[model samples]
Target: MRRRDLLLLIGATAGATAMYQAMTRLGFAAESPYRGPITLEGDPKGASVIILGAGLAGMTAAYELARAGYKVQILEYNTRPGGRNWTIRGGDTYTELGGAAQQCLFDDGLYLNPGPWRIPYHHHAILDYCRRFGVALEPFIQLNHNAYLHATEAFGGRPQRIREIKADFEGAIAELLAKATRKGALDEAVSKEDQEILLEALRAQGGLDKDFRYKAGDDAADFRGYARDPGGGLAAAPSNGEPIGLHDLLTSRLWRGLQNFALYDFQTTMFQPVGGMGRIGEAFARQIPKVIRYGAKVTAIQQDDHGVAVVFEDLHGGGSVEEATADWCVCALPLSILSQIDVNVSAPMKAAIDAVPYASVVKTGLQFRRRFWEEDEQIFGGISYTNLPIRQISYPSTGFNAAGKGVLLGGYTWGGPNSYELTAMSPADRIKVALDCGAQIHPQYASEFETGISVAWHRVPFTLGCAGEWTDETRRQHYGNLCQIDGRIVLAGEHASYIPAWQEGAILSALDAITRLHKRILASR
Candidate 1:
């Protein structure tokens, strides 16, 4: 949807609440860092820019600059468009760091987005790009009340429904607070008038009874769900499940994962491209195909006052070093790899390049013969968190209520010893570990599992690591140096933005970089 249409639709709404909801559903709820389509007001006078890495950041820069009448060329390390915005489907092959290649064995129409899987509602820059590129999107279910939260050491390795845990925890907290208020334990903290209002609010919020007790009854069932759902005729009456005691709930420590669903970033109205995350990159590729040269890996970068020159190897043909030069350069390459390259930049910029470390993450996708999680467990679309090395299992958000095969994100281990350990293992062993860990929560994994693929970000050749891990001190010291226009070269990518490891960050950083570059070009002319 265009900005004007979106504004008109929201303006036509009855109230702010309705407008907010409508804007969310239409993917225009948040204020974008991008002010609609960028228009480079001044001419570049045939200025040329060579962008490294054909990821979202580079493509975005190339797209905007080319439209603004600049000679734009994108040198990509991989043969495909999207860098981490990638997808693995049947018949596709991936080679990791150890020279081990794995061919995806997923069934047709099934795929795994090892990198960026969901677009948060607030990431308006990416959302706008998706809308403009005609990339179809579907709701990315962030929180499914039916999903499970399990810890092998807790609850005897059994998984609890998210709804039950959430309702019971809140209900228990409300009851305790209410009891304390009534007993005048909080007399000093809360006034009598406020105490009475608090008690009333707690009763309603916690599904408490007349005596303000959370127990097995219709009121509690309305929040925690029923032991047996209400039905027609003779069995119409609902049975309430007993609220878990505070002690048991606290000891389980499953409450730690519950807050994830409540975080503002993962709230409702998230989305993903209909087929895969790669659709975004492919769409961008369609707009500027000729300008992007795939399989061109940069080895050295040098910039003089006149222009910037990049030396790279043609990976597809024999590894012959080739040089590409332009009036300016936007190096979107990951800092992890860029730090190692021979780039002629100021000392601080080079130090800034090495200051930020890349994150390590491993993701495993398992294909099952049937939708057992949906049919047997009633888990439609959401993530099930666990303390195991596998971390989380996310059910596919697409293909809901459909009969046939299904794909599950069996494991996603981010950082720590687990990521390093998984990356060190062979692809088959990594898949095996994911299966073993997942089976602890979903026993059907042993039987229902058919084939799987795992991608360890550290092992990903295109990017040595997942994303730049910046600290407060690092950002304070080096962020400006890293982003500043160094001679005729500048940097742009997720690493350059405050919100790292997100597509929105990459696009925003690109937009910022290009805007500055365009200004410099106009001044030069």
Candidate 2:
């Protein structure tokens, strides 16, 4: 049987609790940011809560609220859980705002996570939930030494290996600093004792030779890698790769991509769910299946001191308008969609809703005939950065070396005119752009392409656009209003957190919202 069918069979056969226990036994769980289970301390006296959107934030709140003795009911716009935490697999279909539908045609077990993909190790809340739900985790390689970095105008448009550029750049900087320090250029900035320590550190860190020079030699080759790799036999001597000169390396502008690898969030040891990021949502759904009302497009939100009432349309049932009311509400809807709704909040809150704008992102997933990136280019996993419109190409971290076929993130267009340009095109055209732009970095895309699916977040009906884009000025003026509970209702999601566009932001925002809401419940009683 295919892996997809096997996964389905397992899901059908196993209960949520049993599946979690099984995953625990298999060592699928990891250390988490959140401690153990949350304790609400006191009873809610059977309070009722109406949650908006069944995304991570909303579901997270519902899970904790239900456990704390609150009557929780969730209003979700989509037929499935995991709003932006979505995965596209073979046989799945997606329809955008322009009535353009794309059917995924990837092979069994292959998928495209059009939304959030990588999970940083520090995102404690989401990790804790994954541990609790038994969602399996696997390393998401963010910076692979073998990945490519290409600038369309540099090095004749040929790609350079990450290891080569990183090593060369470090070596060049070390040499420059050493030369300056020896010449007394930094006499005022450094003391004699510290200068000696700095020189020693640079020599070791930059892989410099006995003379502290980053030249083509065995020591240099060990760090940046070799032109001819060392083998196991007597004839296995390695040849050194020359360090890229300071001028050429600076002019190439390839060094700009290196900073992302050093970022606190994108650093090594990132993770993804075993199947897909949506497994987190699916697991959350299992805990509270009966509470969610799918296909409920909330049209208006009105809250009085007594309670909150939401007006919505049943999209699945002939678009009949209906109302749901609860003692309190947690609105996790995206600002892109919520801003248009007739929400009767305070003037400051309304302005805050309108103040933020959502970002535009287009992601395309391409299936290839085989794992040519691994076989041909030796790029097993990680992202390749380029100056092209596609921005970056990510190879799958799973199924390395032993693959009949594979899917890669062909293009992940985030913001700017390029994102808008791609968003305007049809789904097929978007895929074509991805193929054309990606060819500049990996020529194999021209021959090995099989099928593709593209998602332009601006054109997605459910989200209208990607996560909320906050500028310093906008956040200064509106962020407080957005997060503060407006009367009997509060808001939570990635938009409400500092770590925007991340699942951790959404989970953490939910936790904060519920904690405050619980306090209000106790104070009111």
Candidate 3:
């Protein structure tokens, strides 16, 4: 099998943790490259910079440039800051590309982050900024043992606990390995001493009995949970549940869900802002309040050897055309929207802008009358994987065991036919689909659902799609030209960095772009 196929097989059979380990050995997964906060060492001699968009990248560039003594101003299309770093709460209204306006009717304190939800610990730059800006963060639960893994064809379509699948799979594998070792099947491959050590390790890791058997007993119950709970009074002894046979377990294919939590990105210690992901953008905006010009849509980007001029329509001022000039420009607009604008840049740069495509994504936030997932299922904060079109349902990481009214990320569909299918529907129909699909995992979805909202990235007005989607061939052909400083105008955003589709990518790209721009400016003098 090919390496990719091998990894997929491991993920299907063993689990995602094993697959990640194999991938790490094969150089597929890596940590972030952010070192620390950047320092612009030299002055720009009072040079000015024009930053486009009010997203993290634009705001990051503005924040650092203004502190470095450059006169920095940002032109934003939206009335407020945080382009994709947005949050929708009650009383807010959103109009998509097709003029489909949805008013958020969520209860107060219940909101949805339509983009860039979790921040990995390895993403040092964003975390450092959050700390500096006083944006409190809470743990984002990626996996809960009590959460479910559901396959339509598995176990008669009943959901199984993540812990059950994980434990049973591990235990069964250990038993087979032990049987092989006892039969001297590894005599040529392993020394007797090493085999003994391996057996002991497997016994401990798999919660096996002394005979190396993975059967129903205290050892098995310790891992898979007891059939009957141990109480304080008579008949307090816990009863071990019957372990699923290896044949049945393999056929069920529930092990595929194990990969979701084992991937490097979804590992433990992920975090989200206390209020919403939008808090980070709001915090960045707080640092550079006067620098942003809201409701200004850029129509053309023109540049000369002397400076750069950006022509925009004053959205709030009767749509009148206006021009803003600066010594330099940082265009942080998403490529989906930028490719449609008239930009005066080199052929390579323009081609690079048009080369990248945006991903299709749909996220639906459903508010419930009660926290039924917690009250009835004992599932706190975690994700439930399914084979349904909705993909996965993520429970709120905040508000553990709270009383009434909670919001759930009912459905999040990333790329593929499902995302496009959901994108084609009206927002109301999308919500209905979410309710229908999610009900298979949580039956309470229909009754408990109060009101919901959905955001299809393709329909979003400001960003025609989600983050830039770059393929290997596209990156190899155009990534350099995309990041190269085109005269006085340069691009910065998640698309400009290796780590696309992440806020960290946007921050890192902005820092790198500004650092390079600062060097070129000082050299020019």
lDDT of 2 by residue, 1-525 (tens): 864454446655785666566556554443443565677879899899999999999999999999999999999999999999999999999999989999999999999999999999888888888988999999999999899988989899999998999999999899889989989999997899889999999999998888889999987887998888889889898888778898999999999999879998898889999888889899999998699999999999999989999999999999999999999999999999999999999999999999889999999999999999999989888999998989999999899998689999999989999999999999999999999988888788889999999999999889999999999999999999999988899999999998899998998888889989899888998
lDDT of 1 by residue, 426-467 (tens): 999999999999988889999999999999998899899999
Error of 1 at 191 (Å): 3.3
Q: Determine which window of 10 residues in candidate 2 has minimal summed lDDT.
A: 25-34
Residues 153-270 of candidate 3 have per-residue lDDT tens digits of 9998899888888889999999999999999999997799989999999999997999999999999888888788677878788778889889989999888889888887788889
Tell me the number of clashing residue pairs for each predicted model: 0, 1, 0
Error of 3 at 187 (Å): 3.3
> Which RMSD does model 3 reach against the true structure?
4.3
User: What TM-score does each of the candidates earn?
Assistant: 0.93, 0.93, 0.94
Give me candidate 1's TM-score against the actual structure: 0.93
For candidate 1, the C-alpha RMSD (Å) to the true structure equals 6.4
Assess candidate 3 and give its lDDT. Answer: 0.93
TM-score between candidate 3 and the true structure: 0.94
Off by over 4 Å in 1: 1-32
Q: What does each candidate score in C-alpha RMSD? A: 6.4, 11.2, 4.3
Weakest 10 consecutive residues of candidate 1 by summed lDDT: 25-34
Winner on lDDT (1 vs 2): 1
